[model samples]
Target: MFSPDALIASAKRTISLEQDAISSLLARIDDSFVRACELILNCKGRVVVVGMGKSGHIAHKIAATLASTGTPAFFVHPAEASHGDMGMITADDVVLALSNSGTTNEIVTLLPLIKRLGLTLISMTGNPDSTLANAAQVNLDTQVSKEACPLNLAPTSSTTVTLVLGDALAIALLEARGFTPEDFAFSHPGGALGRRLLLKVEHVMHSGDELPAVTRDASLRATLLEMTQKGLGMTLILAPDRTLAGIFTDGDLRRALDKGIDVREANIAELMTHGGKTARPEMLAAEALKIMEDHKISSLPVVNENNQAIGALNMHDLLRAGVM
Candidate 1:
């Protein structure tokens, strides 16, 4: 078996080579890259990505990234395209073709059809003078000095550079389109990121009679009863006019007990924490989570414009809603 130190050294060398390959791409982001972006930007239909072998895998990822970031794109296997999937392509669309050697037969076979259909063709290839590059309206140079594999046969450095170039294209389009977090959330509605961006405090808060609340003059024992009934680990203390006065939590109760304060006789006002952190209904649930984390609290009172407690939320609520 290979020694751990030797394995580590080999891995480091591979990473360094790939890093150099990516760094070299900085200088290659020329007018051709700009033209490719413009072609996709002006395209009326989706971007159809096609490739073969390892390049096909990279093409699939590029298509997905483009789709999620405001550009409509999908991957079609070149072999499938030659058979019948070519019907999915339209004149208004743009074709993004990838091939490391710029001579993948499957992809090369579809070039004439793509041109005949009058679709804009963009190629990402290692050889700038190859047939695919010559046929493309814009050729993105994804050339690398050498493969990171010891045998120099595997698709390592070339694939890395191609993936990075695809990312550059997707993000450039994303910024050009002014795609917002809300727009991204719509694309990833079931993920944690979507929950953080789309969920509001109002969506996860307990409202109306479910709010564990009592007037400021209520006894500490009464506040504890409300907290127990609501199971939110806290109670909101409101003033006579229904405005927020303070908050009393399980932590406060523990401290009051440690200080020998009698829960039955103590006024809730004297035992509560004054002017605690508040949440707005329209505020992002992620933002409310930040407040709770910063203050080291487990709950927050959702207040209206007049500072009246309208709802309440706890850590459990955020966890249940996948906002945590």
Candidate 2:
């Protein structure tokens, strides 16, 4: 077989160089990183990210991660800042300026005004001596010895180090702010995580007259009729005070038939299972699903504190709600 050798060898070299770049990035996370974290954590306004070209793309991504993980941020292109986008940067906001060489003119072009406004600046730079780095309140060193590009010319390793440094800052601030999954859900209400976490039992559970309910003194035939009519696969046995007394399900019917009990004559109170698994109106639908799973049942009656049936839900309701 003829070997197309140079391209394959070059590919391997790119992978190795990038791996080295990432490894070098780890060693660079030191006290300066702590200063960056402190500045972001203390900021009362949004984190405004600014960069040019390839760094601009990375800056946009960093801004999105910061916003999603509970730190409010937005991306402003450095070139656009000179054309009046500079108004987006408020004095209370922290400006994250990114430049691998730390002297990108597009970013530096906005410096005089950004400084005049007295806004806090945080810079990611390979060159500590560069103007942008020297002007910032915090400097994150994203220096890499070489790039994955074989020519060592492109922004490969530098971009990776910058991205890692951005992630490090985001996660540190996220932990310090005590950002929870529920808080993230509130910000992303249209996604699956929001649907799963924020959608409550009351929003999905069957309420009012749709609930399959019967009194304990009712006949087994009447309970079975109620179950068949309501199609919940079960029926709630309620006390006189409207609290749950017991439950009658298809399982109880099968057992009663196995024991030769006459459904027409049997009292539902004697046939029903007393004090079975129940759900509350305020309980999470996901939690109710877990209880049903643990008990090997398919339905649960939601009840009040006095044990009266307030509502009922089944596995089908959960499946329809997309909680399953």
Candidate 3:
């Protein structure tokens, strides 16, 4: 078996090489990269990323980065392209070709069809003078000083350079397109970021009959009953027209008791907070959580312009809705 120290040293060598490779990637972010960004940003259709072998893996990642960052893109294997996948490319699309040697037979084989389609070509290659690079309207040089492989055969450093270059392009276009967190959330609705941005208080608030409520004239006993029945630890006080008048919480009940007010004699108005903290229905749940925190309150009453209790929501509701 290989000694553990040797393994660790070899791993360090790979990491160091890749680190240098990424650092060297900064120079590639020149006019060629800018032109590539302009092409994808102006493209009416998707970006088609094509590569062969190890370059294909990097190309796939590049495509995913592009798609998530606002430049719509997908990866296509050059081998598969020659095997009838070439039909997927069209004049409306921009083709990003990847070849470390700039001479992958599979990618070279499809150059004529790509040109015939009149598709904009962007190539990433080690040799800018090679056929693939020569064909491109823009060429990104992913050439590395050396491979990290002990035998200089594996694609460690080169792939890192290519991946970093792709990231640069993605971020440049992302900023150029003004892609915001909201836009990213729209693309990933099932993810946590989406839940935080897209989930509104109305989506999870308990409304109508489910809302725990009382009235300004209601007795303390009635308010307690409302809170107990609703199991929300609080009750909303509403007006005759069902508009929110105030809120009575367990804290208010405690305060009322401390003041020696009899629950039977006290009305909801005497023990409730008038026009307390409230939230709008369309407000983001994350924003609601901030309101709750700012107020140091556990529950919130979502109200309309009439001050009507349209909804009752608690911190637990946010947790359940994945908004917390």
Which candidate number would show the highest lDDT if scored against the true structure? 1
Alpha-carbon runs more than 4 Å astray in model 1: 1-13, 258-262, 265-267
Ranking by TM-score: 3, 2, 1
TM-score of each: 0.89, 0.91, 0.94
Question: Superposing all C-alpha atoms, what RMSD in Å does each candidate have to the true structure?
Answer: 2.5, 2.3, 1.7
What digit string (tens of lDDT, one per residue) describes model 2 on residues 146-197? 8887688999888988898888888988899999988998889887777777
Q: How many clashes in each candidate?
A: 0, 5, 1
Best by TM-score: 3
- Every candidate's lDDT: 0.95, 0.87, 0.90
Lowest summed lDDT across 10 adjacent residues in model 1 is found at 111-120
Which residue pairs does candidate 1 place in steric collision? none
Per-residue lDDT tens digits of candidate 1, residues 197-287? 9999999999988999999889988888899999999999999988999999899999999999986799998989999899999999999
Backbone collision tally, model 3: 1
Q: Which pairs, if any, clash in model 3? A: 244-307
| Residue runs of model 2 more than 4 Å from their true location after superposition | 1-12
